[model samples]
Target: MSHNGVQTESQRTALVVVAHHRTDSLTAHIGRRTVAQLEAAGYRIDFLDLHAEGFDPRMNIEDQPDWGNREKPYSDEAQAHMQRVLAADIVVAVFPVYWMSVPAVLKGWIDRVWNYGFAYGRSKPRLAGKRMLWLGLGGIAGDDAALPAMQEALDGQLNAGIAYYCGFSHSMVGLLPDAEERPQRLDAAGNLNIGDAISGIERDDHYVEFDRKAAGFVEEFLAADRVPA
Candidate 1:
């Protein structure tokens, strides 16, 4: 297990799944920041840009759940994506919160790639030991009273529903709130109040902090694999 008197595991690889339609969006920026940090930490990054790669989020007849056969070969694209997922030690999905869950594209990717026999349904799951991080950015204000409820819903869906069911060893759901300061905010009476745009200085500060927060979560993920019982 040791090489040159140093212990090593498999060459660390991360499949970073980003679900954003625009490259200029804050969601994309978060994904980029995540990649930079992981690469700097010695991980070979497999960046899965669902939109940029033209991954279909729809489930055709060929992709329906098959309780009988887990190994039915799906579309070449799904199979190929599954291979990339298998090649990585960890998976980090960076996305904007959509209806308190993943975007359609990312959801579709999972529906197809993590199909039965592949991610689950076998006596022994194929994806039992890998780790995962669901990093989501939302436009809701960070201090909004509803943030906790949103986080809880996401935790149950992504962590409990998907990762746990798929047999991942560990999964972390890190929510980045206040990702967007919208152009308007509702008042106590629910009246829309036009909001001023963030000044250049404030915008710069916010993103710098956002980058730090993103890196912090990634670092925590990397450290966890080293902790001893």
Candidate 2:
């Protein structure tokens, strides 16, 4: 169906799932900026603000018993969310690192959304051939010592747990970290000077051009065809 004037058939659809509890934080900024770039690139964007949408992180009481059950019943909303995940060619998860891992909301989103018979447990994954990006933000520096545990956790949790479990190739999993440390010059309203961050990372620009370039590489990787294994 064509929603928001976006053709679901012809145009490539990208779902940007932002899981930041705080709207005014750096996590939100990165989510918004990435969406802007993807939208500008002509991809149909579905900006899913999990917090704003009031998505209950905890599964419903009735559904709790079906945690690992293969025959679990999904509510209409849950079904729709899964459909969206299955429909998209690319899924972008944006959030902040909390305690060296994703915030509870994002983790819960995965727990509830990626269910049995959908994300895994069959001969193949339901979301196979799809791609994903794990875009993260945190106050910690990007040095090896500062983020060793975080990196390992992300690789295990996101890379192994979600992406690989769902049969998405390793090339499809991209990570962008330390968003808060990026040099940025923006007003109180988050109005960033486009040229500054887009110029160069070492430059006095407002945004982090290097980060953007890295994100672009991920986007391009997602759009590439999967080779036979």
Candidate 3:
């Protein structure tokens, strides 16, 4: 809670997971920007770069689900990851879209750390009050015909499939599009010509717009009503 009686970031920590292979990838760039924005909003951030940490996406027997044993201890790595989940008040994932869903590494993290007893298979959820936001970047244009389908698909997977199952109070997916825009376009004569995107100044302006859209998603998530069950 804050000095004004409203909940503030000082009292809440966000566990941010970035799933991308390269540190310099565009997905990682957006993830870093997100961390900066959240910090500027006063939230304490726990940044997890999965690839940099060398997290194994492969599952093993020790990490397998035990329906009868809610007390079954997972692998050492999984156990440590679970501890972080238990610690955070909010969770955020940043990744590139792969097959209209999360990458294998992120899904594997869920499969391993979000174990049966910890994330599900219990009467009361351990992550009951936590909230989540999934930031997915893709090369598809905003005006593309498949945009709605992509959005709906990602929403269902992140919000309904994972968040609800894990007992998150609220979950949202933000899709950042036009990631592969090119400056050259077909002219009236059907010949390619340099478009505004080729200009450095114009490209920067376009990115500013993209950043604004990305920030809007987080603003709404932060303002959401909290309904305790």
TM-score against truth, every candidate: 0.90, 0.75, 0.86
lDDT of 2 by residue, 149-192 (tens): 66777778888877887787552334454354333334546464
Superposition TM-score, candidate 2 onto the true structure: 0.75
In angstroms, the error of model 1 at 1 is 29
- Please, what are the lDDT tens digits per residue for candidate 1 over residues 165-206? 999989999988768755434466867555666868898898
Worst 10 residues of 1 by lDDT: 1-10
For candidate 2, the per-residue lDDT at 34 reads 75
For this target, which candidate reaches the highest lDDT against the unseen true structure? 1
Candidate 1 residue pairs in clash (backbone atoms < 3 Å)? none
Query: Compared with the true structure, what per-residue lDDT tens digits does model 3 show for residues 1-229?
Result: 1112245545677788999999988788888888877776667778899988999989899999988899899999999999888988888899989878999999999999999998988899999989999999877666666678889999999999999998998899999886654633334475645433444887788788877877887777776734334
Q: Please estimate how well model 3 matches the true structure, expressed as its whole-model Cα lDDT.
A: 0.82
Off by over 4 Å in 3: 1-10, 183-197, 225-229
Q: Rank the models by lDDT, top first.
A: 1, 3, 2
Error of 2 at 82 (Å): 0.8
